[model samples]
Each structure stands twice: as C-alpha cells, then as structure tokens.
Target chain A: MNQVIETILQHRSIRKFEDRPLSDEQIRTIVECAQAASTSSFIQAYSIIGVKNKETKRKLAELAGNQSYVEHNGHFFVFCADLHRHEIVGEMENVDLSSALESTEKFMVALIDTALAAQNAVIAAESMGLGVCYIGGLRNNLPEVCELLKVPKRVIPLFGIAVGYPAQNPDKKPRLPFHHVYHEETYQQDRSELENQLKQYNETISSYYKNRTNGERQDTWTRQMANMLSKQVRMYMKEFVESKGFNLK
Target chain B: MNQVIETILQHRSIRKFEDRPLSDEQIRTIVECAQAASTSSFIQAYSIIGVKNKETKRKLAELAGNQSYVEHNGHFFVFCADLHRHEIVGEMENVDLSSALESTEKFMVALIDTALAAQNAVIAAESMGLGVCYIGGLRNNLPEVCELLKVPKRVIPLFGIAVGYPAQNPDKKPRLPFHHVYHEETYQQDRSELENQLKQYNETISSYYKNRTNGERQDTWTRQMANMLSKQVRMYMKEFVESKGFNLK
Candidate 1:
C-alpha cells in the first residue's frame, strides 16, 4: 500500500500524550487540511474550537467524563455542526431560512460536513506523525458542553479531537469482516448468513480481548455492544437539539 | 507537507470522470481504509454498498436528479448510517436495544460514523490518483433510492460517492476565512464580527465564480446560500428517518 493508505490502515486511538503542544503552524495546517474536505453544497456548516486554556480544558475534560487525554493533549479541537453562520447569511440577504435550516435534511448536512472535516483533520495529524483520539464523551453532557464553550444557537458540538505526540501505541482494533460491512449493488438481507459471519468475528474479537488484557477479559463484540446499548445513553439528545434551535421541524 | 497532507490539501470534487471502473482489489483497499476510521464507542455503525449493476446505477442516477456523474463514474458507493446490525446484536444477546437504537444520540453516532468512513474512502481514492465527488443529490428521493437498494430498517442511505479517474481538474473552491471558521477556546458569537469576515469571503467567492465561469456567474456565497435555503428542500426527511425505525424516541 502507498504511504497515505498505510497511514490510514495503521490508525489507532491514542489516549496518552507527551508533555508538548503543537505549534501554531501545525494547528493551522491541520485546520487548512480540514477546510479542503467536501462540504454539502458548499454550505460549510461547521466550526473548530481550539481549546488552549488550561482551565477550560480542565473543565472540558471533566465534562467529557474525566478523560485526562482531553485535558492534556497537544491540542483539543471541538468540532461543531453549525448553522448559526448560515442564519447570518439569511439575515444579510434579507431572506427567511428558518424552514430550511430547521429541517432534518439540513441537520444531516451539518452533521455530515462536520464529520468529514474532522476525519480529514485526523488523517492530517496522523500523517504529521502525531497521535489523535476522538472524544465522543463530549456528548456525556451536551448542554453543559454548549454552556462551557459558549456555543450559540444553531451550533451543536458533535465531538472533540485530542491531538499530541504519542505516549502509547495501542493495538489497532479489528473491524467487522470485509464481507460483512460491504455489499454489492443491494444490501444483503440474509440474517442467517450475516449471523454466521458475525459468529466467526465474535471468536476473533474474543481472542483479541483475551490477548490484549493478558486473559483477564475475553469478550465478544456483540456482548460488548449489548452491554452498552441495553441502557439508554444521552436520552435528552433529541429534546436538547430541539431546544438548541435545531431540527425544530 | 507530507504526501498524505498534500493529497488532502489538494482535494476538489471531480464531477467528470473518464470511462473506467475500479478493480475489485482497488475497491477493497478503499473500503479497508474506510473501516480503519475511528468509530463512536467502537460501534462501527455504518456500511458501504458498491454499485456495479448498470441498471442500478442508471436508476440511482435518475433518483439523484439525473446527475450523470452518479451513473457514469468508475464506481458508485453508497455510504449508509446503519443500526440494523446492532439490532441483530440485540437479538443474539436476547436484550431489548430498541430504546437505545432509536435514540437521537445513536442516530447522530451513525451519521458521524458513516461520514468519517466515507471521507477516508475519498482520501484513499485520491491518494491512488483517482477523483471523487460526494453525491448528496441521492437525498432527493431517498425512499425510492432505499427501495431500489433493498435497504432495511434502521439503515439510512446518507449519501453516495462517485469515484473514477479524472476527466477534468477543476480549480479548488476557496473556503471561508480561516479565522471565521476556527475559533479560540470559545465560539465567537458576535454576529457583526462574523458578518464582516463573511462579507470579505463573499468578495473572494464572487471573484472565484466570475473567473471560473467567465463572468457568467459572479455570485457570493451568502447569496447562493440564501437562494438555496429559501426553497424548502427534502422536507420529508424527518418523517422518512422516523419511518425507517430511527430516532423514534
């Protein structure tokens, strides 16, 4: 494989970091790489908040369920799905965009745009020999996160990226079998066939966990998913998003 | 910049593709790169559908508002936000995950996961000297598209990517001002300050359009946004997603 593909395939989430920060040039280049990603209709409905303040990082780390990596990375960037700017465009052009901006279609555009940019940022960081981890725990307390970040209406903070010099090189987690995640022309709907593939994958994952933890834990992917999904998470997300002036339609 | 970052920074949507198709190995490598992207809580809540059937592509092209690129690309892959597999995991574990699966939080996770993977695939294709375009026009008739693809419940066809050797190299569209999109510590909610930056960007974009189209289209970004958002597009999206057994909570 080529270097770019190699960088992508060698990816692993880095939770530990060295005691150093990225230079302003490095950060700018990373964001510039992000800006080059395709936006839905050039709406560019996203923003990156670079958290350099120690106090703010500390509070954010706490908000993200005490992830020390969130507080101690070379840089922490909060990627938000933002339509507040488009709202401004509506105002500047003397047009009403309330019906469109509040639609779920536009909401999906913002989310997808934010994610595409964030992934580009991740790849750029990795290519620069930096390590990164995505912090979905930011959703642990979305309203509080919005309050802490002073985010305005029509902007939802989706996730954060912790970028730094690597302090730990974790094993790359095995993904679903290639056949399981890919289909040809149409979706494969044979449950028995899919379950058989998952069954084999379950064995691989069980072995992975066993080896990773020195036999202390041997768990299947399905079991892990079941344990997590049996309980509702961020149950207020729908109402919270609506309250934040999104998806009100 | 490294080769990977260089590839990323040079990204532009390629709507015109040479008449060609990606080899099976090439397609596999692209999907592998996509699977390597970080997933929320390791959920990996997405799937890729590779369309090779001429009739299917032709129909999809029609469904996507007759975007010829969607029909004639070397390959068209539909990226989906998928919880159907998770629903299966729930069944095997004999646990009810309906509440969790249908939550808006889970919906966001699926969307984000799908987009991240799709972006990686884009980068991978670009690194291999191929060109790509994101076909958000697939959303024009999502219900019919889903039926055509035989998509199941809890799976959303978010968008399509058209990949191929480039037939044309378009100039990169300039993005919004860096300072306007990247904030420090907290979100800058000062509307006037934001508008001033956008006004400047409007000039840049206006010049770009004029230069690109030989003065045929000298439109500003805000004006374009105002024009698009004024018409309510895809207003059925919210009801459709709910009908697909997602975000029912």
Candidate 2:
C-alpha cells in the first residue's frame, strides 16, 4: 500500500496525550486540510470551534462524561453541523435559505458534510504524527454543550476531537469480516458460511479483550453490542436535536 | 507538507474516468482501507455494495439524477448507512435491538460512520492514483434505489462513490476562507471584519468559476448559494427516509 493508505489504515483513537500544546501553525494546517474536504453542493455547511480556555475545557470535560482528555489534550476542536452561515450569507445576497434550511435532507447534508471534513482533519492530524480521539460523548449533555459553545440555531456539535502527541498507543481494533461488510452487485441476505465466520470472529474478539493490558473487559463483540444496543441509549437526542432548531421531524 | 497531507489537500471530485476497470486486488485493498475507518462504540454501522453490471449502473445513473459518470466509471459502490447486520447479530445473541434500531441518534451515527469510511476509501483511492466522486443524487428516489440494491430495513444508502482512473482532471473547488470556517475558543459572532473578507472571497470564487475550461460561469459564492438555497431541494427525502423504516423522527 502507498503512504497515504498506510497512514489511514494505521488509524486508532487516542485518549491519552503528553504535556505539550500544538503550535498555531499545526492547527492552521489542520483546519486548511478540513476546508479542503469536499462539501455537498459547495454549501460547506460546517464550522470548527477550537477550545483552549482551561475553565471551559473543564466544564466541557464534565459534560462529555468527564473525558479529561478533552481538556488535557494539546488542542481540542468541536466539529458542528452548521447551516446558519448559509442563512446569513444568503440574507446578505437578498435571498433566503429558509426552505432549504428546514428540510431533513439539508440537516443530514450538514451532518455528513461536517463528518467528511472532520475525518480529513483526523487523517491530516494523524499524518503529522499527532494522535486524535473523537468525543461523541459531547452529546451526553447537548443543551449544555450548545450553551457552552454559544452555538446558534441550525447548528449542532456532532463530535469533538482531542489532538496531541501520543502519550499512549492503543491496539488497532479489528473490524467485521470483509465479506460481512462488503458485498458485490447487491445486498446479501443469505450467506451460508456467515454463522461459522461469526463464531470465529467472536473467539478473536474474546481473546483480544482477554489479552488487553488495562481495564480488560472479557467480552466478545456480540455481547458488547448486545448490551449497548439492547435499548435506546440516547433517546433524548431526538428532542434535543429538534430543540436546537433542526426540523428533524 | 507530507505526501498524505498533500494528497488530501489537493483533492478534487473526479467525475470522468479512463477505460480501465480496477483489479480485484485493488478493490479489495480499497474496501480494507474503508473497514479500517473508526466506528462509534465499535458499532461498525455500515456496508458497501459494489456495482459493475452495465444495466444496473444505467438504472442507478438515472436514479442519481442521470450522473453518467456513475455508469461510465470503472467501479461504482453504494455506501449504505446500515444497522441491519447488528440487528441480525443481536437476533443470534438473543438480544433484540428494537429500541436502538429506531433512534435518531443511531440513525445519524450510522450515516456519519459510513461517511467516515467512505472518505477513507476516497483517500485510499487517491493514494493509489485513482479518482472518485460521491453521488448524492441517489437519494432523489430513495425507494427505487433501495429496491435496485435490495437494501433491507435499517439500512439507508447515504451516497454512492464512482471510482476509477481519471478521464478528466477537474479543478479543485474553492471553499470558505479559513477564518470563516475555524473559530477559536468558541464561536466568534463579531462580524466587524467578515463583510470585507467575504467581498475578497467572492472575487476569488468568481474568477475560479469564470475561468473554468468546462462550462464557464461567472458567479460569486454568495450569489450561487443564494440561488441554490432559496428553494427546498430534495424535500421528499424526509418521507423517503421514513418509508425505508428509519425513524429519522
């Protein structure tokens, strides 16, 4: 594989960092790389909030299930799915984006566009030997997150990334089998060997957790997912999303 | 800048392709790189369907607003935001994921995870001297497209990517300026300097479109957004999402 592919395939989420801050130049280049990602219909439809204030990070850390790395890292950024910029820019040009701004399609567009950009930033940070972790737990307290960030209507934080020099190297997590994730021509409903393949996968994951050095949870993939997905983990997110002015009707 | 960062920063949507199909090994590598992308809570909530049959491609091309590159390209893959695999596995483990299967949060997670994976695939393709274009037009007729792909419930096709060798090198499109995109500490609402910056940016984009070798159009960024965002594009997507058994509610 080529260098770019190598960098991407070696990807892992970093939750620990050394005692160093990212230079302003590094953050600028990362943001530039983010803007370089493709946007749907040139809408861009996203924004990045860089967090460095000690007090704010502390509160944010508490809100995000107390992920201290969100405050302890070299640099932290909240990637938000934003449509307010388009609204403001449209108003300036004597047009209104109210119709487009209110659709579920545009809502998903903003979220997807932000994700595409953030993934680029993640890859860019990784290429520079910087480690990053995505903090989806930020949504644990969405209203507080919005209040803390001063995020306006039609904008929501999808996730946060903590970037810095690596203080810990986590194992590269295994994924579902290739055949399970990829299909040719169309979807496959009946695979005769899937049961056998999954049995092997369960054993592999069982061993992975068993062999871990820290906080080992001896559980296979299915058991973990069964526990996590058995119920609506974050049901309040629906109401919270609408309360943020997204018409996710 | 390193080669990976350079490659990512210089990305452009390639809609035209040369007369060459990807080798099976190349396709396998691309999908492996995709599987390597980060997933939320190890959900790995996505699947990819590779389409190569000319007739299916022709139908998909029409479904995706007649984007002929989707058919003419050497390889085409539909990236679906899926939870079906998880659902099936849960059934095997005797844990029904009924509640998780219908949450707005999980819905968004699936979409974001799929996009993250697809972006990795894009980078990997670029790293290997390939080209790609994400086809959002597939949502134009979601039900029909899903029918064509045999996509089951809890699996929505987010977008499609057409990959192959480049037949035409499209210019990398310009984006909103760095300051407009990246905010420090928190959101910067002060617009004392934004108007002036936008004016300069408008000129930059005007020249970019005006000087294009193909279908030159003299338009500014704000003006273009104003025109496009005035109406509700893809208004039917909300109902279609619901029809596919995704409670995006």
TM-scores, in order shown? 0.99, 0.96
| Candidate 2 chain A least-lDDT 10 residues | A191-200
Candidate 1 wrongly placed segments (more than 4 Å): none
State the DockQ, from 0 to 1, for candidate 2: 0.76
- Per-residue lDDT tens digits of candidate 2, residues B1-249? 999999899899998899799988989999999988888899999999999899999999999888889899879989999888777778779987877777788888888899899888988988899999999899888889889999898789989999999988778888888898898987876665656667778998988887884546878888888888886778888777776656554
- List ranges where model 2 is wrong by over 4 Å: A191-196, A213-216, B191-195, B213-216
TM-score of 2: 0.96
Predictions: Cα RMSD each: 0.7, 1.9
The best candidate by DockQ is 1
Model 1, residue A30: what's the lDDT? 94
**What's the true lDDT of residue A241 in model 2?**
72
Query: Scoring each candidate complex against the real one, what DockQ results?
Result: 0.93, 0.76
Instruction: Identify the CAPRI category of the predicted complex in candidate 1.
Output: high
Q: What is each candidate's fraction of native interface contacts (fnat)?
A: 0.91, 0.82
